[model samples]
Target: MAHSAFNRKESRGAHQRLDEGCTERDDVNFLKHTLAFYNPEGAPHLEYSDVKITKSAPAKRVYGGEATAQDKQNKEKANADDMKHVKMEVMRYNPETDDAPHFVTYDVPYDEQTSLLDALGYIKDNLAPDLSYRWSCRMAICGSCGMMVNRVPKLACKTFMRDYPNGVRIEALGNFPVERDLVVDMTHFIESLEAIKPYILGNDRKPSEGPNKQTPAQMAKYHQFSGCINCGLCYAACPQFGLNPEFIGPAAITLAQRYNTDSRDHGAKERMPQLNSENGVWSCTFVGYCSEVCPKHVDPAAAIQQGKAASAQDFVIAMLKPR
Candidate 1:
């Protein structure tokens, strides 16, 4: 549970250092604030290119190699050659052959540019052909390659292996029934999304009727909530979804918000109870992990929060009206 204390001075999306040593020891109580970063450049400087220029007196040109660019490239090549490989212990399960699942270790060639997806590809190509996992659109757009790498939910295409070189542990995504090795049952999540009436009920007239008019501001209001790819990473990260299976999770709730907030849709009042029901928005405790694990930047937690507020406002407005 590596975490950092919250600093109000920094923006919500700004980078903050994680005091891993202090957090593991449980020395002090500090609130953890998770934020999203789009690229590796947003990570710590050492995680990527380590070359830095510092000013001591007059900003001297300090090179670890000669003035020639090829010299430095050769030095980096030698540095990479000296690095060692590591073992990746992945959970293996086969319903047809094996009675139970077990961890299988595979020594993968490691490098700074290698990703967890790369290691898995190597295993499937050279080491083991029977290794089972779900993956599509390796660029993270399909959101199918999500898994628990070292007990943390992450996208295989985005999570680099260099950050964790010493033996790594890969497993299926949490809070779901294990279907096979590195694959989990997604039927529950799919059903939950369907339960929320995910599509827009934009029909108030017949097919020959005029189009539904909508303002630009109204489109902008729900635009941010429409980027969900239903990765199920948020459901795995959410404790509420773990406790109650009918919580609707984040993806569906965000989808509901997408429709409910749209000016062209006339079902906001009809969708109010579904979003505010006992097992719906009220079940979420604002864990905020939904937004944190979202790969598409669709902050479902914020959508659920706004849903609750909308529900409360509707309730109050109804109570104030005369009979």
Candidate 2:
């Protein structure tokens, strides 16, 4: 109800919130990166929810002393429910006016149900009408909302805001030039997607025969690779692409894999020459980041690795057969 009370600049803030019930430390690295500017040395406050936090110092452990298991669980749950909300300071960029990006803090009343995408939408609707970012589907399927949520490539729609208890910092996808606030040049990702010839390749005979017969079992082989939504999240997450822009990246590899595994396709033999070349499938070092950041679960790393195996097999059989 009191949005103004939470809104303030970084230099001043009289109200302080305490967090409690740290269920996991897995996100410590991510939090450290997101809130680094505000709490340079260490985390300024603890992150928890209304279900968490304590009124006073928690009872200390005594050697060999233990509370009933149910009692301990109830206490832990209570601590988690008492957590408080905090502010998120986000970096904003304007290509038309500002030479560089600047930080703008927002007092986002935290709730366990809040997501980074939800927060961004709230800010855009309430705090800043001019703020720019891309989002198609509120779900991760669209992949249009992929960006750096605290320096990690992720889909804004999928990243939960409450996960970052301290605060959050959002940025455009890394390794690409920003067009404006959160949009980056997707030309490279598009071109690479095109490079692998994403469309199905067929001979004149196949069309004459009508729909090429493909069994359900056959479709199963390549189903995973075919799930690609042309999202460039894999490319942004790929260090290989960062090192060598010419590298085809994961999405393209998956594209190629999609066609190659099709039962009726013969182009796998033909595409082998192109895929085996220096900047083709061979360039992938299998860093596995592409798979990690994929919002669609289209594992480009596995596709590329599988492509290499297919290529290797082709080479072996070609050499063994008649000259």
Candidate 3:
């Protein structure tokens, strides 16, 4: 995997090569699945197979800043007067009043740029004032509006209404008990995060001792994992977490790796107990869905895999040492 990544001379998605500035997709030579045959004694044999383009042709995706003021005003005006409406079947539950969770549909006037969060806001303000959900910072940064949209975990602020113009179903994040309408009890997830010791540990140095600095190379090692916003979307997408709630799960493990990989941190040994346990990195099946749903692209699956390798090496070294 490392060889293939290093050989690829382009910047695309999460894989960026410093030697090669962002280059156009090489569809002719590189649009294929690479198959590596392992050799225990020597370098692996590499082969490539043609990728079957199923739905659409590959194209360059451009990410831009927010819409201009005039554009926003035009869109808002169009949405307010537009007769077109989208049906939103939101999951409703009130433990204090309801026996079980139920779905309530609402028709929301929307424009091409209206997001799921916007529709929910309209429903709250207009149709159903009693409706309950969590949201803040209508942008994706807050990570408070995570929910299951059409059975797929997504940030409500990031999902556009146009993507599901016909209609859409919204529910609380999966792999968690519902606390109320579109709100899940996050106690377990938070506990798991705490178990990994998300912060720097055993740093006894004081301000008088001087600052702890890190090089760009050292920062690059764990920078990707540090982008996690604790949205819990990775937990929702993790089938392992769904099956066994005891598993440490993806985000927490990734956060552990973030600190473990920091050159300035000495917490790897302290955190090894959790990372080497039965419910640790060994529990992951590498489904990779966690990475798919991650808004920050933290790639928790890769972090867990790296943790497994480190744990295995540690076990061998421990076994070889005399008591």
What does candidate 3's lDDT look like per residue over 38-154, in tens digits?
Answer: 567667566677767789768966456655656755765575786578889999999999999999998888877788998998888667888888889988898899999999999
Q: All candidates' lDDT scores? A: 0.78, 0.74, 0.86
Q: Which residue pairs come into collision in candidate 3?
A: none
Model 2: per-residue Cα lDDT over 115-173, one tens digit each: 78877876775568787888888877777888887788888878887788888888888
Q: Tell me each candidate's TM-score.
A: 0.68, 0.67, 0.74
Best by lDDT: 3
- Give the top-scoring candidate (TM-score): 3
RMSD of each: 23.5, 24.9, 21.5
Instruction: Kindly indicate the candidate among 1 and 3 with the higher lDDT.
Output: 3
lDDT, model 1: 0.78
In angstroms, the error of model 2 at 12 is 77
- Cα TM-score of candidate 3: 0.74
